[model samples]
Target: MKKKIVFYVRNLEFHAISKNLQTIVNSLDKKNFEITIIVGEKKYSDFILDNFSKEIKIKFILNDFLTSFRSKKYKKNFKNKIFLDFIKLFLNLKSIYEIKKNNFDTFIDYQGMYLSDFLKYTSIKNKITVLHENRYIGITNDKKRKKIKKKFKNYNKIIFLAKEQTNDFKLLYPDLKDRFFNIYNCFDINKIKELSMEKFTFDEIKWVDNKNYGLMLSRLENGKDFQTVLNALGELKKIDKLNFNFYFLGEGSLKSFLEKEIKNLNLEDNVFLLGNKTNPYKWIKKSNFVIMTSHSEGLNNVIIESLILEKIVIANKFKYGAEEILQNKYGFLFNNENYLELVNILKKITKENKKSTDYFPEIKKSYSRFSSINILEEFNKIL
Candidate 1:
């Protein structure tokens, strides 16, 4: 009999977790396993339905939570934190019940992003939680760490995206080290390369029409450190006599702040915020280069995608994954904190090897080592 498996994620965003989970789903032998994906939000239901429903079933936890008036009204009321939590629990209980009826043998939380979503999966005997960000494990207090460790002990396995992430978590709760497994995020290299082939007219992105550019597909969030990246661009503009517009293509809370900062730095003409493109790979393929300025990350999917498309990349030296991915080849990594160093690296790339496309051979070799085929044995070893 095939084992019934379910993958759960609270966020409905089409992002790394979604892509990585899809990779895992695609790798599973249908003769041996049945798959289902349960997401908490329904707004992006079609995203999974359209791409993945042929092989796996799709379900939602909080059905219509995005369109529900009570949910929306309560979200705006800051003082109703306790009430909001109570209402969410009421809604999630039904979702938990629905999932329980399916009797899945394995339940995998793609990213332990929402604690409530994690709590809802207790009906499944085999619980596997994947923690994507090592740098975001913010529990420093001994008491809280102990409590969290106790919660983690309930799961059969806790997977980290990288070894550095595993080490970071072990520092918080050493006893859980035995239960931890390191599984680097994997992708379909050929699929991404193929998707990058889809043609988009210049009108698809108007700003790039007349500009030499660097592309950054970052969420406008604090962790992305957009300020430091903009500052470095400002510095480069001041020194180097070259014209390059930096295109930022993702959405988050910091969009207005970043826009104002760009204006303040006199970079309104150079830094363009393009707000979450469905096909960022198209821009990645066309840009002069791609960049990552994350203060920290689990493993950036875009970096790998950029490499698969053979784009010259300038990335920040993040705590865990950048070194492992870049590994002094295929791309350049500068100090994310040091503005001057970032500026200098940009200067060197522009002056020395700006329009080069020779990285595909090395990038393909590295990407192959991290592809789903290579990751399959490691993932199954734990089971």
Candidate 2:
């Protein structure tokens, strides 16, 4: 019998978690698993939906009334505590009804956020939640940590993208250590190469046309440490070694801040913010290499995708998943805190103008372990 599985996420935004969920959904064997995706938010990018198989079903938990009630328009109109309480009651009841209506064999929380409040009340035997980031990174509060630990007890299993993440989480909740499982995110290698070859005109190609370029494929928000990257560029310019153009392919809250910083650092000519691209692989393929300076990560998908595309990756030695993914051998690793180190590495890479073919043999040997077939076999064991 096909296992009826439902994956729940807060929203299907153009982010790493959503992309990882998409990859898993597409890679699963349709003959053995019947898939359904439930989203908490009503508003989401259909870009992920466009790529999903037709057989996969999608449902929104929030109805039009609840969606409008949660919107800016309704908040401004309805400020009564009694009305707010009524909305909360309706939502909880609705969620409970939605969950109980389906007798799913497995319930997977794709994102660790507690969007599905009624999940704890569900009696599903195979309850799972996937934590995408380093849980203990910025969280310093003891109360919050205890609250999260209590929440994890509701799940039968917890999926972590890196072994380090699994180990750290185990330390936090020693009694629940047996519930944790480390499963590396898988990639569709051939599909990534095929997408890179897609015929799409990038108008900003002129910026890096004949020059060496490095791509940063991430959201422009906190914890990314983009300032360090810009500072490194500033240092490289001072030494006259800043020959390559740096492009940011994703959008976020920090766009204006980064733009101002770029101007302040006099890196207008060396740095370009290309905003979010639906197909980032094309940009990754065209660039000389990829860069990641995140303070915390759970097996960065961009770094993996860069390697799959045969592009070199330069990242910080993050405590969580950086060394595990890069292995400290495949790509360049610099101190995320030290801009001077980043500057030196930037100088070295630009001066070398290294080709992907040089690392092709090692890259292929290392990345093959993350293939879809291998991941599916492991994933099936859990299901």
Provide the lDDT at 252 for model 1.
82
- Local accuracy of candidate 2 as per-residue lDDT tens digits, 1-383: 99999888867878988878888999898999999988766756678778988889988877666666665433334455567667766665665566668889998877884534567667788888888887554577999887787788778888899888888778778999999999989888888899998755667567556777888988988978898888888988988857688898889889999999999999998798988888888888888888898888878888888888878888898867778887866787887678899877777767877675564447766678788888988888888
lDDT of each structure? 0.75, 0.81
Per-prediction count of colliding residue pairs? 0, 0
Report the alpha-carbon TM-score of model 2 versus the true structure. 0.92
Off by over 4 Å in 1: 45-48, 65-79, 113-123, 135-138, 208-211, 354-361
Per-model TM-score on C-alpha atoms: 0.90, 0.92
Instruction: Residues 2-59, candidate 1: write the lDDT tens digits.
Output: 8898777765566677778878788777888899887766646345446764778877
